[model samples]
Target: MPDARLVDSKASFASFSNVLDARLLRALADLGFARPTLVQSKAIPLALENRDILARARTGSGKTAAYCIPVVQKILNNTAASSSDSQSTRALILVPTRELSEQISAHLRGLVTYCDKEVTIANVSSGTTHHLQRTLLSDKPDIVVATPSKALALLQSKANTTLVIDEADLILSYGHDEDVRQIFSSGYLPKVYQSFLMSATMTDDVEQLKGLALRSPVILKLEEDEDEAANLTQYSVRCSEVDKFLLIYVILKLRLIKGKCIIFVNDVDRCYRLKLFLEQFSIKSCVLNSELPLNSRYHVVQEFNKGVYEYIIASDESIKKGEQDVESEEEDAAETKDDNCDQSKSRKRKHRHKGEGDKEYGVTRGVDFVDVSCVVNFDLPPSSRSYTHRVGRTARAGRSGMSLSFVVPEKEWGKNKVVGCVESTKKDEKISARIEAEQAARGSKIKEYKFDMKQVEAFRYRMEDALRAVTRSAVREARIKELKTEILNSDKLKAHFEDNPLDLEYLRHDKPLHPARVQSHMKHVPKYMLPKIAPVAGAEAPADSVAQDVGFVPFKKGGDRGRGRGRGRGRGGKKKSDPLKKFGR
Candidate 1:
């Protein structure tokens, strides 16, 4: 029950020299890590002493490196001390998702960059064939990363001396509790191995896991300081179903938002639907969900971090709902049945295989998206916890970020049945209120953003045009089509992509899924449609800069070529009366 505040804030990497190996120190320095994070400073020392640990820290707070450094250090020390061939799996790190397994493995590789020959690692949840994975496990790598179900079948656990369950709060919700029980209860490890359970939040499920895995462990609850919490600005805007599309189109197409953004939806169909709608406007964004191959999803995140893509339309469908959620959804279905029987059946059919999506795929929590400038909740999440994880993707590592959520009024739910999500939308006001209270309890404020929707009414036609093009048939087709394409890219053509670097660059995830009609005019905003307050290219600030207070959207007037350039003259050199030059007067 130790509060993390008592931990020494001035603890430095040099202080760990007594406990850490020299090679590990050199590797950390090579990675440009000057000082240890708070969790790292506290956990590393205890972990080095072989103490079982249950630690909680915020996301992107270097939790991965905290445990990894100690584990790698221990293995390095053991290899030096042992005389014989000590070629056995010494550590097992379990995660909730394949993406996280790969992430941890990559970080481990960096930590062992200078000592690669001495330590080896494998990821059993990498979507490779079990035969291939079994073959890989036969080498007895020093470290193994996997999800619980994957490890239950392939792991020979007698030789392992250390176990780590990353994202401990999520593992049980993903329906891995049984697999975990089977692994630990059925003689999966040595009797005296050290254990580490690391997570961003602690819940009853995590408390239960402490009993199953850890001994009398050191519990470290690291609370975020005020300065770190202040880095995020949360905003909520209430809009109709159609207005959500119009506002997002205006926000993105007008270049109001700066840097990379992640748009989160509640359902898989909504993910493809928003992507296809944006595609009509030629906005380049990749889709991430459980339906795609794990390798392709990892590649999408890699490309985004490398600045290859600016936006990612993701659905947190992989986040398993709790028992309360199940009961509420059943109630919502019954309510919908009386109002519209046919729509309820359609919704039921759409979700007949809801649980069939990859249980081991998660994006809202464990999967890190680097330098995310903003998070747009295209659909309100079902719970306050889900809301926290969605916004947590940004405002990380002391970086300032914004989260803008769209809340549908109770009166406006299911107005346009096409883009409507009945289950998640029906209680938008309630969910938003809960979210506000939760944030307020944490000393954070979620301001009600007052956006003048009338100013951007001009974009409604374009939104409508694009929305019509993305029909139900079109969305279904795009989903099937993208899955096939990603399968080819991830599995069938694995060797081909490995050999051809240029071809890999050309094989983009954001390519247009164009089963719908391509409205070329929608791609470019017309000059006459510019809002009066938006800044024109090469123009000074407008007199009414009140809109600047909105903060999330910096309205810039782009896409105009001749305005305020060359004396507003056309190609024929005729001095034309430029309407944009008169804007904001």
Candidate 2:
């Protein structure tokens, strides 16, 4: 296993949050920071000294200020580094998600403005376009706040400078190994340009990056505060998958948590859906995900910071490599995100300058939603380190917080690990049973109620797959029927129609009509207008005159059967005959 520990710890400041530099001090005072968090006090001075640093600190532990202070101080000391020009980016701070970057940048903006300086910090993350990030990287800026892949592509462009991979180990072990290599290999980052690696877990790849990227880099360590530790109350709940969501909803209803909170899910789509469900009860929520546009993701975070949204659903493990159900680079390479194999000796190797092929990785250590009041897990993280990271979002920077991790029955993590965090919410007999029953009930309700989301998705894909091949014959009859059934089953879909059910007369049928016809039309148009188009054009027209003739006729021929049949038909006596063919009856 790689040594996931920060090797060097020399503390000039007692806390990572301390701002010792005069200008930084002024900014801090202006921003209302009373004192340094342990990590900040130590990491800041080391960073100011321009060392490749690997520091372990929890979220809200003032880690951002720990790194931010030094970078801002460096820009103040060295005018050449802070440039408005696009290609001259002095500092590149890579975070795990766009939301974190936006949140941090907002804080940075406040500090810089108070210090009477103007600086631009751009966020490059999934929710945003690669093109925009490339443009920024190509043009360069004072500093770039980005996710690994986005930054790596820019760095690979050889628009090189300082590289600071916050949560270096997280990125390397989980997400963006290939991209990290590109950044690591992207030409010379001179001594004047600094490298800083910050994370709570010091996995080996991060240490290697520190050694290879920094020149005589300094190291710092901060111990968690005793008071903060005492203040935090940790606990867990054991339940089935369904119960977990219900537990969370009940927790919310009970108002057991205070301040803004973050709930960590394993997937982005889940987060999005959860946010919607929470909103039904008048609770404002937001989601942070890779699929959201970068700026949109950024703004959602801004809203979180501004307290406009009460809860933000964050999937800490989603963006990482190897961890996702989908195969990623780390998994492809037969490694986990926190792989500590091939850890170098603690005796710092002087800037080996190994490139991408040398096994690149990053850490998710630095990206955290600070000051979170509570952390609830939809599922236990892949490992203990991930568990810590999820819980770390709360109880950070000397602040007190609590956590509630929901462990579903038969989930990979058993009862022991899930209940380990709680000092008081220990495993017991009836509570566990209650929790499990709740989970089953929630799931049963969801399943029994006829909401088949996956089917809906599959149907969508099926239509896309089949629709493009619309042949001369009808392409949608089966699909349409299937979709109609699905719509009838879906609460979301049904609610949509009930609100606007084509308002057609057929929709007004006495039997709470399925309005299958109206639904089919409403599927294509407004509910009220469904009847106007659904009856098949000319279906109501006079019956084909030839229909009065022989029961059947060849499709292409028979010369307008209605016309033929009408002329052939005699009053009352003879068998129906066709006018065109003199058939004996």
Candidate 3:
């Protein structure tokens, strides 16, 4: 909105592109980068001049090259420095994920490759052989790209003259904010050196980053376009717990919003369970959690990067510990009892976490993915804040995204059991209080929907009927207009209609309008779902949809799904059914 060149190019971007150090430009050409993105064009020039910058931009915006080109330019172009005493790492680039670190390192190599200067890069992604690190650090690298844990450990082992933080917000939000500070605590880099914190969102922690990390800094924020949501279309479905996975299976089969998706959840175990469930559907998926070793986590991330895994399920705790919900004793006790009752059924429901809200789910928190398009919250988020974040994962980077949150009106937040009313978080409290006050002032009506569990499918069918009725009425109203117009023109509207008796309304959408009435199963069903059953009927999703899944793994092999196995755990070499297994039989 402000009057500022988003990119630094004053005239033609080509002018500067042509002027780039020959080696760097050659590398750019090799990488197929002809022109710079708006952020890159603006940020790179300043960085080349050693004028520290703070520019805001989204991922896939070419920010990496914007900074990388100039830094590599300095390293390769340094003619005054002598090789004899010219030691110590000249630049350090740190990132949140090992995959990201590897990605940056890969690009850095390309950019520096064209240079005649013999420069070495130290890559500190997870599971790097210790012997390799010892050799590189002692021999000395001109550049180092690493994750905080590995980089910090390496720097602790020795010292670095320079450092950089790629996803600064991740470090802060993930309970590793202190670790970042500690990485610099050794006073390795100069106090006045440059530090970059890159991310799409501008949370308060991002705005406050410089105070703790850098000196007076330059700040540039790139606003997402007004049409960012143009490509995404959203919908919410309510379903029974038993039908939830089936619904996901159906959607994946449809492949409507295809490509890789990062499934978010609040719990780690559920992430693995969902991963396994998705695998059962023959979908490629992987899981991310704190319990797994760094290498295993790295493997999952790498698999995703390589397109080997199209789905990743992870928790909010790993993203940012304090922001998510802790599994209280109540949930554990209930889960334990259910597990003891029947292990198979319990396993089916294991990762499902049917009615639990986003607080306990990972995708409900602030972390986001690169190019996801659809966010599906199998269960609703606990509050609007969680809901806002969950759905925000998709339709990103100047593209459109959609969110779908599942609600089953009959069940409480935990299950079919009538758990006491769920307590609202600070965010929900604010929303509820503000809504009530606004309603009282305007004398507007409100609807409440209560939760019910058993009749979920039945209620879903009822709401489908009502929605169909409304849609039919709308169609009839349109026909009435045409008939009246025909009468005025003295033309035969009925003759044309009879000739084409197809259902025009059904042709409007691909998926059928059968979301299973969410109102019928709510602990406090909102009036919108079923005026009588709604806990709060007038409430609308603040954004659009909520996100729920973030981890993926395989729970069953293909043979288990075969009809020949005849259900009941399937294919354990059972004898033909006698229709009776009694003692006499």
Which candidate has the highest lDDT of all?
1
Instruction: Please give, for residues 448-530, the per-residue lDDT of candidate 2 as tens digits.
Output: 11112331232233222222222212212422332343334333322454576453222210121111112121122122211
Best by the TM-score measure: 1
* lDDT for each residue of candidate 1 in 198-221, tens digit (9 for 90 to 100): 998878889999999999999999
Q: What is the lDDT of residue 6 in candidate 1?
A: 45
User: In terms of TM-score, how similar is model 2 to the real structure?
Assistant: 0.56
Model 3 RMSD to the real structure?
21.5
**Model 3 bad stretches (over 4 Å):** 1-13, 79-85, 129-132, 156-162, 232-243, 278-284, 291-309, 315-320, 324-373, 379-401, 407-411, 416-585
**lDDT score of model 1?**
0.80
Ranking by TM-score: 1, 3, 2
What lDDT is reached at residue 332 by model 3?
A: 41
Per-residue error at 432 for model 1, in Å? 1.4
Model 3, range 1-585, lDDT digits (tens) per residue?
112233346454445644466666767777767667677777766666556566666544566776777667666555345556656677888776654665677778888886635567878664447777767777668788876666666773333433456655554655556666776676656656666666555566666665655565567687444343333334444454435544455345334345666655544444443444443334545555544444334434544545565666655443224332233234446655544333454445444644332221222332335546456665444433344455556544445445554554443233422111112211223343333353344332222212233323333443333323333234334334422332432222223324553522221111112222223232222333221211223554233221211101011111221121101111242422211111010
The true-versus-predicted C-alpha distance at residue 314 of model 2, in Å, is 3.4
